[model samples]
Target: MTSASELLALRSELTGSLVLPGDDAYEAARTPWNLSVDQRPAAIAEPADIADLQAILRTATAAGLGVTVQPNGHGANGDLSGVVLIRPKRFDLLAVDEQARVLRAGAGVNWGRALERLDGTGLVALAGSNPEVNVVALAIAGGQSMFSRRYGITARSIISVEFVDAAGTVHRVSDADDAELMWALRGGGGLFGIVTEIELALYPGDAIFGGGLMFPAEVAEAVVTAAFELARDEPELGLDVGMMHFPDAPQAPPHLRGRTVATVALVHVGDEATGRAFADRIVAVAEPISDTLTSFTIGSLAAVAAEPVEPMPSADFGVALDGLDDAFAREFVDAFTRGAARGLTRCGIRAMGGAIADELGAEFAAVGATQADALMSCSVLLFDPTIDVDAAFAPMRDLAARYPGGATLPTFLSSGATLADAYDRDVLDRLAAVKQRVDPGGVIRSNRPLG
Candidate 1:
């Protein structure tokens, strides 16, 4: 065990605060955005800058403590015991180059802040539905973004990555400088090192046709079939269909109280006329109870899925599908509706194809290799004080077992999933080689470590 005197000596070398177990701020410091996870880290370090981060790494290594880094902690797993949790929110720097269509964001920057910086520039970053998620983390983990259909996964857009390795050595890597590390960092999770900043390429587009179309629970099967057809027929359009169960809680909207609904959310990158035509095709499938589809600025992209903005406790299970065929669609609709009745709050299947499947070169390869046609996921909020969270997740688990697919995305894999479950043997071997080269000591550890 590290003595208090040693801990204090390590703290003296940093320009940031260190919260031990007894510190008043320790609980909040260790708390992640996903409230369901309870991470009791040995110590929490709030690094003010890169220099402080280096110090923390060196100090932790000297003390023989494993280091885990989290910017906003969106994907926090509950096994952080005996590890030094480093929160680098102080490196919140964002620089946008409109002329070159590039964005350089620090580890502390989130998608919402990056979008704000790119406003009115006729440019958009490949960002996920949750605007508050950390930009660096998402990019490193191969983000599935709003524009994933047109542009591939978000990790392929990275121009460069700046990180400190386990040995406390700083390295700025790109496709040219370190091709192997670049490939691994793109979607290899946080095993190699602690990334401090990333430079990403941005696309040129301002207006997008984006919104949701909600249908009554009775027509969910038909809706899923229609949405699948749309995804297959028009791979250029970004689309996701969600089967939701809204409880009769006081916090829920009055109209949706105690009801199950199927929502088809979409975003098209082209002109408003083409977008309207696509929306019309969906409307032709079934009469929507609510239609919010309209032309909107890219800044408002997060509203397309209507994902909750605030932090909350959530558990999710995901599986990749070869395609959402008629049989699978019916099965999904029935299973989701039944699961909702059993306490599942949200279940969604996102269409994945188009540029996502294209060969983006070995250096740009990410976890979401263009093979899977769709991704199905289920989530539940742990809000009720008396509810059994594990029991609530049972239905979703059964659904996954009944309709198992190829490989799952590392970005959306559950805590129980292993690296082998997300990657092929060849890919896993390559990732392990890279990990051995960069973090041979295994000083840096993440939720999914490359073996």
Candidate 2:
């Protein structure tokens, strides 16, 4: 425990946003997206620079206090007791080198900043399902998206990184330097340290077409079949699709605003003419009540999906499957739709693997071939903050077991309190070894292991 006097002196030494127990913003500062997760840290430090982070690290260690560093509160898990919460919201910096086809963003930067920075460059970075999520945290957690079938998971797109370690030392990790740490940090979350900055491989694209298309629930089987057939051919054309069942919530779109339904969110990452033509092919199968399928630059793409930005309690868990065949699609949708009506779950199945399964043979690979190009990512989402998480996840787990694809991507994983159940043997072993080396004292333990 830090002494009151020590906390006071430490506050004076830091040059950044600092919130103590008595501060009005302290409670808000400790609140994460999961309303159930409440941290009562000795102090919440939003460091202005790397030096400020180093000082906080040394002080916290000396005081026998742990530190929980988060870019955005979306992915935070487990308790943060007797700790100093370090948030890097002040370190927002993004630089794009168009010629090099890479983007460098600071820890504080989010998708909003990345989109703004990538404008006019005719380049698009690997973005998550929702653009409101943090860029670095998502990248490290093995990011996946509807476009993943073409570009591959987000972690494979990283070229280099700058992170601060447990001892306050900052190191640049890349294939050319510190191979082991680079491999570990890629998909291991923030176990090694707080990533200060990252460079991601970008693709040239002034315009790409993609958006949500809602269909009547009755045609789900036909929709899944047509989509699979389209996936077989259109992958070379940068096509990706998702079929999701949303609850009859008020927040849903008017056409899909209520009643159980399967909405297909599709994307074509090519020229405008080709994208529109492909979209026409989709609309040919079944008329969509609401369609946002149109060509747009990366900067304006977020509007294509129109995701919410405010923080709320959420549970995200998924598994890959062989394929979305008619029989399987009908059964899967029926099970989930029935569950959703009872206020048990909201599920989505994202078609995976095309150009994404091409295998770059990069240092950090996400979901090996044995795992990729299977079918779709089957996941459940729930909003009840007090929902019984373990019980809620059980049905999904059983459903995943019925499918053949093994190993769930780490980024889509939530509440993985158990190591063995959370990861397969290979990943579990590698992650455990990396944790041992980087955080030897086990000082960094969150939902995922630090050591």
Across 1-451, the per-residue lDDT of candidate 2 in tens digits comes to 5455567777898888778888999888988866656657788889999998888777777777777777677766666777778788987888988999999999888887788778788888878646677888888877775566667777778889998777888888888887677777667777677678998999867767878777777776666566666666676444444445554666566555455555666667777787777667667788776777777778876777776677755665656666455666666666655555445445665566675566565436423332443433333445544556556556556666677665556655545343343356777678778878877765554445532
Cα TM-score of candidate 1: 0.95
Error of 1 at 279 (Å): 1.4
Question: Cα miss at 307, model 2 (Å)?
Answer: 1.6
For every model shown, the clashing-pair count is 1, 1
Q: Give the per-residue lDDT digits (tens) of candidate 1, residues 229-347.
A: 88898887999987898879986899999999998999898788988888787788789999888887767777666678777887778778764688877878777776776678888
Residue pairs with clashing backbones, model 1: 357-370
lDDT of each: 0.81, 0.68
Question: What TM-score, over all chains together, does every model reach?
Answer: 0.95, 0.89
